[model samples]
Target chain A: MPKIKYIEENGKEHVVEVPVGWSVMEGAVKNLIPGIDADCGGACACATCHVYVDPAWNAKMPPMGDMEETMLDFAQDREATSRLSCQLKVTEAMDGLVVRMPKSQH
Target chain B: MSEQIVIIGAGQAAVQAVTTLKAEGFAGSIIMVGDEAYPPYQRPPLSKAYLLGKLERERLFLKADSFYPEAHCQMLLGVSARAIDRKAMTVLLSDGSRKPYDKLLIATGTRVRQIQVPGAELPGVHYLRSIADVDRLSPEIVAGKKLAVVGGGYIGLEVAAVAQKRGLEVTVFEALDRLMARAVSPQLSAFYEQAHRAEGVQFCFKTGVEAFEGHGKVERLRAGGKLYPADLVLVGIGAIPNVELAKEAGLTCQDGIVVDRFCTSVSDPAIFAAGDCTRHHGHNGEEIRLECVQNAIDQAKHAALAMLGKPTPYREVPWFWSDQYDLKLQIAGLSRPGDQLVVRGDPATRKFAVFHLREGKVACVEAVNAAPEYIVGRKLIADGTPIAAARLADTAIPMKNIV
Candidate 1:
């Protein structure tokens, strides 16, 4: 199992054990996290699953693709470390990564 | 040094573009001008859950009140941008204020196409688009009165579903041969016709509404050489893009404001357009305009990238979804006029996916009450992979492996 930590806007952190193949968005949604709506259900069509990865773990994750990059641009309060959680497929190297959710999802 | 970006509409496209700009690290002054008083909100739910009083008004908001400040964008509501001075790079609002911008985005979107019948302006007739329209119509749905819905598109059908669920006598009048003639295949349309009919929704297909008969409020609809009585009428023929501002500003306008794949105005590099208001060159070299929320958000991002001088081409597959009753219809890719459709799953069970093939290539997929198929179908459409008809029609095989 791959462990992931999600920090909400108020600086509250949640640690969840996710399957290796599941995307970060899927992990949060399956665990019933407060954020990560995933309205389009991991289709990368909607930006509701937007999150900002910790800069320290940025290099550990895969680079954003065209589709993910395009969807991230529509996310609210996007930052230089912004990534669509649905696009981030979990791997062993990505364990213990931290992501921050925005205050609101448009 | 920072530049100013002014958007001419406060619709979905405008809101998405503002967010996209800030996300891309564009430190610029952003201003959104719109005729509506409120910020951009979801329009799809207005005719469904919102109309049935199942969803709250706050949940329908696209963003919170603090979103603008957090994103560092300014909104000018209840004021329309009357004209654009291209030479001076300024937008003139109706209030006689001129705002200069280094880059201008046209996301004015579209307005409901009004009926040309005699009693179109009648008191009881309405069009569903803005929150104001939904607020006025919700009480009627709750009153459990008779209703007549003109046009059989997603809007009309979704509203009819909600009205019927609310225990109203609902009758739908479609001028075309089938429901959603332009958007869905005949099989899918037939499935919906049967499903709605089963839900006590009366259908009057191939009927042209000639006039609305009433003294001050609508009482009857004259169509198909017959008069049908109604307590309220909803006219949802379609929508036409709000391109008057762009056209008046001397930008090239056809069916909509013409833009390239980059969402940049074909005639001007400084001006870009997106959303339902702009018709961009499609993959097949035809001018195409999409009205769904996906297009609004995606095209806005493309336009933002263009404004940033990134020049990212917009080539994502167009997808749309509609919810009616208990069925959720998701469609991916664009289908041509005469594409061959293959049906998978049983319409009798009210759960199936229809695949449209053009010249042995998958053109589109429409799934009704089928979630897994819609997810897999979208990926296949995006990949443009060819799948055998027999394989697609076989329900035993999971769709994920087909691609």
Candidate 2:
């Protein structure tokens, strides 16, 4: 399991280990972490599971697909490293991956 | 003393309200009443992944068993809410107890519309709505078995896809002329009709079921004045909103439990309703009752806010998805009249999108195996973005660039 770090907008920190093949959105949702609503359950249909990836881990992660890039535009206050956590699959190489939640997921 | 909040129906909307209320610092005593024996779970995959044996039963649950108790909420399982007492602010349950509340939420959702025909109650006849429904029909989904499907809507087509993959002889019966007639455009319907046929699934157009004929079990269906042999029958015609409780309670029930933009009941201030059981006005000033997960989750949040004394109008874009085989059909925005469609990619390629434009503004989008259009199209619908028809139809320009 790759341990992932999740930071909420309120500056709350939660470090949890996510099993391989599970999504980062699942990592937050299954562990009862607040912030990511994930209304679609990792379908990539709803962008409610929006997150800001750490810039350092951007190059090490899989390139954002056309769908993820387009869906990111739906999230509020999107940035350069904005990604839909549902599209980010957990991997051993992504150990210690850091993701920050937006102010809200509405 | 803390306030008392009561939520009826332990599904997507019910769970969402419980989680949101706690997250928003509501110290009220929450009581969730559900008729099912299991916890609240996701129902979308029940027709697709779970039916095909790709997903296990445990994955259907929306939350773990421990999550509910940890939130300090009361769970009333295997109990149906019989009626609502608006005057007393109490809910009458099947267990003969009146659960009083300071705030009440009616998230009863919808029930599968049972087909009223002869031999309908025979064994092997199933409807997929809850976890038990799928479990009951799981064993009959064997190879070489004839499966008769009623209705060509999303659930019917999705189950057909799964049955086809599992080596079942599947045939869909739709009263309409095409597949998913009410939900998708004619172009997309034709595409799916062909796609399913190519994958060895049969379809019956303009066919209406007359009866289900068999001895002690459903072995054939009488439709279009013809008898079709079958070992199993799946009814996916449609659903009726579970609004009898509200109707009996004297709440304004018009097609569903009528609510304001804040998701509060029109008849009472302390009562709220969400999900498929709600009939509320949209941002466009039109009345609508949505049945998808998007409405369930978002409207539940708004209802939670209203219960927390932070009432905000619930107005947002409507979106839905259907996964069949390797193809994903995503739709955004509501249906409208007098809208013209512009095809983005060729259907022959099996990767395309249809953009519905009304007065040069994007009204709705139907994307098949094309996620970018569905994702970007949602924003266009939300922003009311206007664009040239030629530009939208041109494959050379990317969806993001067009906006």
Candidate 2, residue A97: how far the Cα is off, in Å: 4.7
Q: Which residue pairs collide in model 1, if any?
A: none
Task: Report lDDT (Cα) of residue B320, candidate 2.
Answer: 95
Tens digit of lDDT per residue, candidate 2, span A1-106? Answer: 7999999999999999988877898888878888998888877777899998999898877888876776776668998888999889899999999999999886
| CAPRI quality of model 1 | incorrect
Model 2, span B1-403: residue lDDT tens = 7899999999999999999898887876899999999889899989988888876776667876777877778999999999888888899999999999999999999999999988899898999998899999989999999999999999999999999999999999999999988898889999999999999999889999999989999989999899999999999999999999889988899999999998999998999999999999875668999899989988999999999899998878889999998788899987675689889999998899998998888889999878778877877888888888899899899876986
In candidate 1, what are the lDDT values of residues A1-106, reduced to their tens digit?
A: 8899999888888998887766898777656466776655555555689899999998888988754664565556879999989889999988799999999876
Which tens-of-lDDT digit does each residue in B6-51 have in candidate 1?
A: 9999887887787778778887789889898788777777887678
TM-scores of chain A across candidates: 0.95, 0.97
Superposed by TM-score, candidate 1 places the C-alpha of residue B225 at a distance from the truth, in angstroms, of: 2.6
lDDT of 2 at B400: 69
Q: What is the lDDT of residue A33 in candidate 2?
A: 89
Best by lDDT: 2
RMSD of 1: 8.4
What's the residue-level lDDT of B347 in candidate 1? 91
